[model samples]
Target: MTHETTRIHPAALMYAEEEKAGKLSRREFLARTTALGVTAATAYGLIGAAQPAQAGGHAQQGGTIRMQMEVRALKDPRTFDWPQIAYFAHGWLEYLIEYNNDGSFAPMLLSSWDVNDDATVYTLNVRPGVTWNDGTPFTAADVARNIEGWCDRNVEGNSMAGRFAVLIDDATGTAIEGGIEIVDDLTVRLNLPASDISLIAGMSDYPAAVTPANFDPENMLGNPVGTGPYLPEGLEVGVRATLVRNEGHDWWGYAEGKGAFLDRIEYIDYGTDPSAWVAAAAADEVDMFYETTGEFIEIIEGIGWERTEIASGASIVIRPNQLAEVDGMTPYADKRVRQAIAMAIDNNVVLELGYNDRGEVARNQHVGPMHPAWADVPRIEYNPARALELLTEAGMADFEMDIVSIDDDWRKNTTDAVAAQLRDAGFNVKRTIIPGSTFWNDWTKYPFSSTDWNHRPLDTQILGLAYRSGEAWNESGFANAEFDALLAQANAIADADARREVMAELQQIMTDEGVTIQPYWRSLYRHAKPGFVGWDMHIAYLPQMYKVGLAA
Candidate 1:
C-alpha cells in the first residue's frame, strides 16, 4: 500500500482512540494492547481510560465530584496563599488566559491579546456575553478591579501584588502605570511603567481572577461571585464548601471532552490530618486529594485509586528573618551567617526523612528544572565544616537562633531535621512549630522559617514577585539594585534566549547574596478515584477542577 511518510501510525492514532473510549470489548482491548506492543496494565488504565466523556457545552445534566482537602483553606481569591482556593476561584472568576489540557496556554475570558514592540503595552480583547452570577456584566471594569486589588498591599492578604506592580498605576483604582486607555467595554490598552514580557502570564497569575468593581471582603468569605459555570452555594471556613452548577452560564473551556462534567462539587475539609484524608480516599468517600505524602502512597495505591506523579514547580526554602528582631534569629541578617545556615542544612537528608527522597536537592536559585527559565547554577552542598568556619568567620560562633515553621507533619519534621543539622554545626537552634493558620497569619514576618512555594511558569515572574527588592511577598527581605536591574532587563528583552541568559545571572546573584536558604524541591502527587475522567494536572501547582467529571 502506498503511504505518506509524514502520516501517523493507524494503530497508534485513530484505531486505539476508537477502542480506548470503552467502545471496544475486553477482547478487542486486549487485541489492540498486544498489537501496540504495550502492557495492558499501563494502557487500559484503572478506571478504564477507554470511557472518556464526549464534550459539548456546560449543558450536561451531571453528578458531583466530592473532594477532601487539608485544613487551612483560602477564604478569598485575591488573598489566597494555599492553592486550595484555586478550586473555588476556577468556579467563578475567569482568567484572561488559561493553561489548557494539552500543556499549552489559551485565551479564556480574553478572546486574544497583542503586545507592542517593547512589550510595555498589551491590548486585551475580552470575551462577549460573560457575566457575573448576579447578572452584572463582566467588563474592563471588573478586570481593572481584580488587577488593582492584587496590586493594593493594603487589601488584606494579596501575594500577587508585586507581580502587577510595574504594569499599572493608581488612577481611580487603575492608571496604566503609563496610562490605561479603555477602547471599549470589551477592549483596553494597558501601558506599563517598565518593559515586561511576562505581563500576560502575570494576568493569568494566581488570584488574578476577574471580580466586580464593588468587591467586598465579607461577601468574598461567604461567596464572592464571578463569571464561572458554578456558583458557591455555601461555604463554612475550614469546614465544608458547597458549589452548584450555574445553569445560566457556559463553561468557557475549549477542545474536545471539555465542559462542566460535574453537576456540583462539595469540598470536605478533613482538617489537618493526612491519614484521615487518606482513609477517606481508600474507602472511596472522597473523589480526590490534590496531595498525598510519600508515607500514604502504598496505602492509596493498594486501594486501587489512580495515581499521578506530577512534575510540579514547588521548592522548599529556609528563609531568614531579615527585618525582624522578634526571634533570636537576628543573626541571620549577616551574609556570612545566612550562608552558614544555608550550607549546614543538608537538603538530601531533609528530603529523605520528610519526602521519602521523592524530590531532588535544589541549587542556589529558586527556579527549578521544570521551569522554562531554569539554568543549572552552582549547587550549595551540605558542609558542616564550612558552616562552622563561616559562623566563626562572622564572629557568631556562640550565636543562637529560633526557626519557625507550620506545625504540619511535613514542614515540622523537615525543620526538625534541619535544626538538628544546624545544631551540629556549632549553632544553638530552637524549633517553634506553629499551626498552619497561625504561622501564616503573620507569615512573611516570621524569622528563620522554612517555606514551601508553588510554581510559576516563568522564572522571572517568581523572581519579580517573591524575591524583588521591597516587593510585598519578598519573604527573605531580599533587596539588591543590581538584581533588580538584571530582572528588569530580562523582562524587557522580549527575546527568549537573551532573557534566559539574564535569568541565569539573576539566579547566580541571588545564590551569592540572596537571603533565602532553599535546600531542595518537592515532587507533587495527586490521587484520584477511578471515577474521575478528563482531570489533568497543572504544573503551576493549582487544581483544574472544572475540566474534570465524575465517572458515569
Candidate 2:
C-alpha cells in the first residue's frame, strides 16, 4: 500500500490543521505533530507534502508516535550494554545539560552555563521544575551524583568513565579529587586543576545523562528516570520499550509557546536489517525507524510517505583494537603498516554502495566540515596505486589480513567492499562477519578487527576517546606521547584560534598516521505517512518525542 493511502489517525488530523494555517515552520510543525499522537510514518508523509519552506509553516498538537528499531535489549544508557546499539535508549531516557548540533553547543537541561578563567571552572544553572520519570525533581544534586557515578572507579559506569577520568585528572592535575561541588539547590560548580575548554563541550553527550540518587546501577533496565519529556511505561527485553508523556515535564528545549501534546510513544525493535524495518513501516505496523541505510533511500523517497532528511554530522569508522594481541602477534604495531591498510580501502565505493550518494567521502580526520575545527584541512582521496607503494615500502608486499565485522547485512556489505578494494591494492584481504551479539563482546578482544564507531561530540571528545591511552573506547591500542601532549595542550588553550590550530594538527596526525580510517560521513533520514509532524534531527540522531504532535 502507498504511504499516502494510509489512514491518518485523528491525532494526525489535528496536526494537519495547524500545517494548513501556516502557524509553524516545517521542523516546528513536525515536532508539534509527533507529540500530538501522529504515527511516525504519517508524520513523514505530512513532511513530504511540501518543500521544507511550505510544509513547515504550521503548529499542531496531540499524537502517539511509533518508531522502529532493528535488534533489541539496549534499554540502558549506562554500562557497555551495546555500544553500537543504544541510540534509542539514550534519546528516550537521558537529558544532557548541553548538546552539540552542527558542532555548536546548545543548552538542554541546563538553562545557562559559563566557563571560568582558562577553562578551570564551570558553573551551570539547572532548569527548575524538571522532573524524572518517577516524578522526582531534577536538581543540581542529580548532576553531581551522575558525574560522580561516571567517574567512580568502583562503579565502572561505562567505557566513558575512563574518558571522564582523563578530563577530571587534567582539570585537577591530580586524581579526580573533590572537583564537583554543589553551588546551590539549582546550581553546580566544577573546579579543575588545569584548563579544559573542551570538557564542557564533551560532557554534553547522552551518556552523561543525569541519574537520580536512588537509581540502581545493576537493575537500570526496567527503572530509568531522567528529565527528558518521555518516560518508559513498558519494557520487554529483546522486544520493545513503550514511553508515555512525562506529565511533569514541560521544559523541552523547543517548547517555547506550546507544550508536548502526545501521551504515548512506542519503540519497536525488530531485526537488524533496514529492509526488515522498512517492511514494518510500509505495512503501517510501525511508525518510524532509526538508522536508515543508503540502499533504502530511494525506496523511501518514492514510497508516498512524508520524509525528513538531515545531515547527522557523524561518520562511521572501523576502529582496530590496538591493545589486543594474538599468539604474541601485534599486526597493527607498525604505524606504517596501519597507514598502508587505511590507504588500501576505497572510501568512494563504500560511500556509493553503503550510503547511496547521500554523504561526503570521509577524510581520515575525525572532525568534519560541520565542525569549527575543519579549516583548510585537505581531504584524503582514494589512491590504490599509492596504497600499494606504501605497502611495498613497508616490506609487507604480500601481507594478508582478516577484517572482523558484525554479521549485519550493511556492515557485511561494507566489509566485503573494503576487502575487495584491499585485494585490488595488492594485499590479501579476508572478511570475517560474525553475529551482532557475539561481535560486540568478542570483536574488541580480537587483535585485528573492524567495528563501527558512531555519533560522538566534537573533535576534542573524539580525539580524547580514541587517542588517549587507557580510554574505555580506545580499542585501537594507539598511544603517542606527542599526540597526548598536544591534546593536553589543546584542552587548556582558551584562545579559539589556538585551540583550532591544535585541533588541526591532531586531525592531520590521524590522517597521516592512519590510527583509524574513516570512509564516509552518514546522514539521518526518516520515512512516515503524511499528516504527522514534529521530528527534528539532532546530532545524536534520536528523535525527541515531546517536541512533536498531530494536526487538528
Candidate 3:
C-alpha cells in the first residue's frame, strides 16, 4: 500500500471514533471519511466489515413525510436553475452519485466508478437490473445519452453544458464524436479532453440526473419514468407535488435491504415566507420543511423539532449583466463601474442585517472557506466614497441601474441592503422585487439581479459551470481568457494544496474584474419532527428521500 492510503486523515479518524461510539451512522462515517480522501474499503475496515443498514434495524416503514417547500417547474434536468427542482425530481429521478452534506460521496444509480490516475478517463459501472417505471431497462446507453445531453451546448440554459464542457467541441457547440463510449451493458466510459477531478461530483449535481435515451426534455412531468422507489402521483406546479411508493416494484436497492422507507412523500408550497412555514410547523401541518434561515431557525427549533445544520459554501450573488445596456450605455461593461459597485457595499452588513449573522462575511470571491481550494486573500476594503470616485472616473456617476430580486425573506433583505448602500454612494438605483413564481422566468437576463448559488465540492466546479466564457450559466456574462486557462490548470492538478495555488490567482482575477458581489457563505439549516429519521440538511439543499423514514 502507498503511504497516502496508510495515513488516516485527522477528521476521518474522529469520524470513525464517532461511528464506534454510536454517535454517527455507518453511512455518515463512510461519507465523512471518504470525503477526506480515505478509501471506502479502508473506511469500512476501520468500522468493521459487518455493519447494519443505515436505516437501523428498528427503523419503521410505510409512513408519509410532508414538507413545506416550493414545488417548481421541472423540464430538462440539464437546465434546472434551482436545487428545489432537483430535490423534488429526486423522488422519482435518481442521480449517478450522492454528494452528501458532510463532503462524502455515496454511490447511487452507479454501483461503482473508477477514475484513471490522471483523472482524464472515468469508468462508470451502472447498477444492473434497474428498470424504469415504464419497464424499460436502464443500461450504459442511457447513461451515455445523459452525458451527451450535458455536453450539448445547443440546449439553451443547460447549466450542465458548462460542467461537461470537456466532452464537447467549444466551437461547434456539440459533443465530441467519441468522448463517450458504451463499453458494455453496464459500463460507460468518459474520455475527457483534460484531467478533471470534478467529474463524479458534477454527476451528483441537481441538473445531472440520468434520463432515458429517448427522454423528452419538453415533457418531464408528463413522463416521470425513473428507477427511483417513489412515483410522481400528483403535480400542481406552485401548489403541491406528491409521490407514492411504487408498490410491488422490485427496486434495485431493496435487494440490499436499504432505503425506500417512506410510503408517501409530499412537498407542499408555502411560498417564500418563512413565517408561513413556521406557522405550519406550529400547527403540525407539516412533518419537515426544506430549509430554515434567520429568525425562522429558532422558531422551528422551539417547536420541538430537531435542527440539522451544515457549514456550506452556499451564498447569494448580486451581479451585473455585463452584456445588457441602460440609457444607451452598457454601464457594467466598464470595469470601473463593476468595481465601484463591488466596493460600495459592505458584506459584513449584508451578513448581519440581511441574514441576522447566520453566516460568515464573504470577500466578494465565489470561493468560500468550506471549499477545498479556498484561499485567504486580501479583502477588498469597503469604501463608498472611493466607489463614487471610481463611478465618476468611469463617466457613470449618475447612471440609473436596476436591481432585480425575488421577494423572498433573506434574498430581498440582502438586495435591499445592497440598494441602500449603492444609493448612499450617490449611484442611481431602482429596486424591482418580483414574485417567486416569476423571478426565475428570465433570471439571467436582468441588468442587475441577485441569484442564490448552491455549494459545490470543488471551487473549480462552480467556476467552470457559471463563470467560464460561453457557459450557459454565465449569468454575469464574465468571459476572461486568463481566468478560464488558470481554471483548467487548477482542475488538472489532483493535489488540493497545489490546486489551491492556482485558485489564489483565480480569486484575484474574479475580484479585480468585479465579477459579482458575493456577500456571505451560508450556514444551511433544516428542521424535522423529533421522530424523523434519515433526512439531514444537505449543503446543497438536496433531499435523499428514499433513505428518509419516520421513527416509530
lDDT values of the candidates?
0.67, 0.61, 0.82
lDDT of 2 at 343: 75
Runs of candidate 3 with Cα error greater than 4 angstroms are 1-58
Ranking by lDDT: 3, 1, 2
State the TM-score for model 1: 0.83
lDDT of 1 by residue, 1-552 (tens): 001123222333433565557554343333323222233333345225552233223334488888786434545566767667777656776676664322334456766565655667777777677767777777876665565566676665566666666654535333344356667898777778777767666666666766666666557646556777888777776777777888776545533235767889888887666788887876777888767776777778778878777655576777886677753446667889878887887777877887778877777578766554567777555688998999899888876688898866677777788898888888888888786656777778876788888766666778887787766677787788999889878777654445678878888887777467676677777778876765555556555676677655
Query: Model 1, residue 201: displacement in angstroms?
Result: 1.3
lDDT by residue for model 3 (1-552), tens = 111336666656666777799766555566545644455667777877653346434558888989988998778888888888877787778887877654567677877776666778887888778888778898998888888888888988888887777788878887887899999999998898888877777888888888876778677767777888877888899999898888856788788676788889999998998998888888888999898888888887787889988877899999998988777777799999999999899899888888898889998889876666678886567899999999999998877888999998999999999999999889999999999999999888789999999888777888897789978788898999999999989988765557889999999999899999999999988899888787778878766777788786
Q: Give me the displacement of residue 5 in model 3, in angstroms.
A: 14
What is the alpha-carbon lDDT of model 3 when measured against the actual structure?
0.82
What's the lDDT for candidate 2? 0.61
In model 1, the clashing pairs are: 20-50, 21-50, 22-50, 169-177
For model 2 the TM-score comes to 0.80
Q: Which residue segments of model 2 deviate by more than 4 Å?
A: 1-61, 74-76, 80-92, 98-104, 133-136, 153-157, 162-167, 170-175, 246-258, 375-399, 455-457
Residue pairs clashing in model 3 are: none
Best by lDDT: 3
Model 3 alpha-carbon miss at residue 406, Å: 0.8
Candidate 2 on 205-256: residue-level lDDT in tens? 5556556777664565566655566665766755777767655655453343
What is the alpha-carbon RMSD of candidate 3 to the true structure? 4.4
Candidate 1: misplaced stretches above 4 Å?
A: 1-61, 71-76, 101-103, 153-156, 169-178, 221-223, 248-257, 327-329
